[model samples]
Target: MKIVTWNINGIRTFRGGIKKALDSLDADIICLQETKVTRDLLDERTAIVDGYNSYFSFSRGRSGYSGVATYCKDSATPFAAEEGLTGLLTNHEGPVRCYGDHTEYSTEELQLLDNEGRAVITQHRIMCQDQVKTVTVINVYCPRADPEKPERKQFKLQFYKLLQGRAEAILKDGSYVIVLGDINTSHRTIDHCDPSDIDDFEENPGRKWLNCFLHSDKQEEESTDEEYNEAYKLTSTHDGKFVDTFRHFHPTRTNAFTCWSTLTGARQTNYGTRIDYIFADCQLAEEQFVAADIMPEVEGSDHCPVWGQLSCSLLPSSKNPPLCTRFLPEFAGKQQKLSRFLVKMDQKSIQSEQRNELPGSQEEEERRENLNPSGAGKKRVLTAESIIPKGKKTKTAKAASKPQGSLLTFFKPKITNVLPSTEAPERQKNLDQDEVTSPQNPSVKGSVTKDATLVLDGSEQLCTSSYPKDNDQGTKVKTPHLTSQPTVGPSDTKKGASSGFWKSLFHGPPPPPPCKVHGEPCVLRTVKKEGPNMGRQFFVCARPQGHASNPEARCNFFAWVDKGK
Candidate 1:
């Protein structure tokens, strides 16, 4: 499962980036901070995406102030939602003082951080291994302390303390926790573009706010009307119930910023701060990380999208065949394993022998003159005009029978499927008619083409991918090459242990299926339909060598893809 946390700055203006993130990364959940739009002003487009459920917490007492929103993919569900600091509202010290403003807020307003909707927590049910567990994701748009206003700065600190306490309380309920969003505090100097850009360190309360959460300055402070927040804690600690996911993975890394200041032109100059983050519990952080990267390309917001993938024990789709894989009878057994290069070689050898020696009969006299321009029989042809109905031109074959139960791969080869390269060589789009017939509305008899979408995978069958390169740098972005035509045949054996698996998977078009009746090769054919069997591919019987068409040709046996695998 992939999760993305991005400070969109404002939902009204930033939804475009949300769409791009969804399309580009296919994240499971997207947490947006500083969504300035309220429910009343939220248009239909902003409230919902076609395949996701959206939840939002709009700011109170203002049209556009502070807000947070979470988008959950259709596959996941959020069972509960809590707005603001919930019970923490009653635990505040008292009414606080601000720098410039003399006016003091009431206890309720101060506790709730002026009802700006800085946070919202949603509980999602996730399937982990064999059991179902809950994950509470708290999306927070923590207030940024205003340099000119002392009250806002104090409120920001208060909000931070409340958020930390609430997160701890949620953990007590036994659910995995992911506290995500724009915390609005640069925890370290490396978090921002440059350390020298910072101003006051000792007198700055906002600077102290981040250090407080990072488990620094652990000395006990004297108690007074002002209650100082506790020292920072790690996700594994009871006191520090959250792990900074990014920082944990890249402890010493620098120059990874999530938010930029447009007014100061920080983004243009690459001088921004990494304020937004996805903080999770220790267990999830340690064992479930799949990828952690800042998507600098996603546009339409002051802050770029930051996303990470986790191999959570949810669905087992990652281990199964690709969702697009399908089966057809024309490619049964030996049919899909035949290498195109090998087939051409075999055909070339047969053509030369036939051209040098003529048949000894009148029946051979008719077949002697080479019908194909390529000096070879187009393919191992097999089909009886008598067996085929007089008027019908095409046949629709059903898929191979499903296994008795769910397929559990006992010895399935562990091949690292690589994403295709963008600069792959280009070639013709259409499959050669003689090599692999194109299935049409009125399909004619021919060998099933390698380009058909039908895919059959059994214990011994090979499954190939066009993209075979490794990406050690990070998570790989899948290329469009595999979905295109197969350009290269299987590569020769390689150095790694998985080299054999790679060889099998990257093989060319297979030889025709074996005929059960006459031990001849069954010619593969494609079945095209406007309905379910659009990409169907399979094979029919081709008479064996030295055998011409006869009245009794029962060798034309038909089978579904990989039926004998």
Candidate 2:
């Protein structure tokens, strides 16, 4: 199967281009980024790609902004909105209620306050026809460059961390995973058209974003400055993980970039760096890895599509093949033609060999003797004894070149370390030496700073009362003074506030209590006693009186939860 990933820039304006890509490329699965249209705004009629099931994960944007969509061919269903990395549901708490102040702010500010919701990364599990194999595909579009504003850069880094966590979890299943989309960070210098132009100073907003992603843990001890610099050279500052796929398919050719600027018009020259990528597990690399750009003539998005094909086998006892893959339209016809040609060539070769060995009549032998008078007259003497040359004994060059030993043996290319340039000393002098520690408030770690201290008081009533109220004119008011107070302990503060203010402030709402009907000691187990779904243990009412038939049930509650082993 072949899968293609492309950032359609804006689906609305480029719907025709997208259609053309789908028609000409014939991707079995197409992962699109920056769709820029919400579910409600999408024109389904035009969005439809014939012979493929479509799924879209649009960002919560109105006009031009981030969004992603995927198209899958075959029985494999596109992830529903609730499934897949892009669709994970994030429950964002409403803005913290600030108490004791009334300040003027605009309706836009009020809307900003309302935008404090969390996002959940959706995960989709695609099961191929053969149930034995499955693969998970994620589409992401990280935040872009905006130096004047640093928050967008920070958001991009944070988004990558979240995406990494999600990816690690999905990989735990041991299934072939393919993550495609505009990751936003260029992993190396080769990934960018102009790497020298990238500013590495602290004031350079993009540099901070790059540093955040490349050094997520801030572990200065783990990586040398040179190592980090080399990583940067291999990755684009615009999108940091360019070398990630290279590491997966090591010893292979390295330059496989997808995104290029049309303004440059350098497509024919191949001068552009690779931005988009298709990353897969090493196990699936051989049978399922391929990447190439869609033609620039395809007037679609600024970015072209890159695709990969996967192949796997199944045994008689196996219910399904051991792999599930997405396909590309560009490869389908070519693959079929190649397979047909191979079979025909094999048959023709076999027929020719058989005809050569057929018994000849006396007339035919005489005709052959006339054609080769010297051979017929002499007792077909052997002029020379053929001997297998040392390396030529093997049919292919690769086989001849390989030394006999374990198949795992491989030639490691010698790597030379290049010294840093003379400008490095000046660049080091300009770098910031101070490290920014996490704020005293843990809540602020993953939240916006302006409202970080809002819910210090643990009392639910005080928390609710603190929220700015709407005045008689129906305009919402802000309480700037309330946020001005220095940090104070719960004991030193006013009465009726809970002592665990820090905990209460960040915890948001409480989760539902465990079901009493299931009782205290319910054991979970995986068993295949009943049927295909039987092994999965679901929470059941442990209380005898809580049984469904019992009218006097002590607790009529039972909630199912996965106690992952």
The sequence of per-residue lDDT tens digits that candidate 1 reaches over residues 299-352 is 667788877778774432222111110111221224655553233335454456
- Least well predicted 10-residue stretch by lDDT in candidate 1: 319-328
TM, every model: 0.47, 0.41
Q: Which RMSD does model 1 reach against the true structure?
A: 32.6
Q: Which candidate comes out best when scored by lDDT?
A: 1
Instruction: Write candidate 2's Cα lDDT for 435-545 as tens digits.
Output: 111334322111112222333333223322224444446565432222222442234544435445655666532333455644354323244444566656544333333
- Most TM-score-accurate candidate: 1
TM-score, cand. 2: 0.41
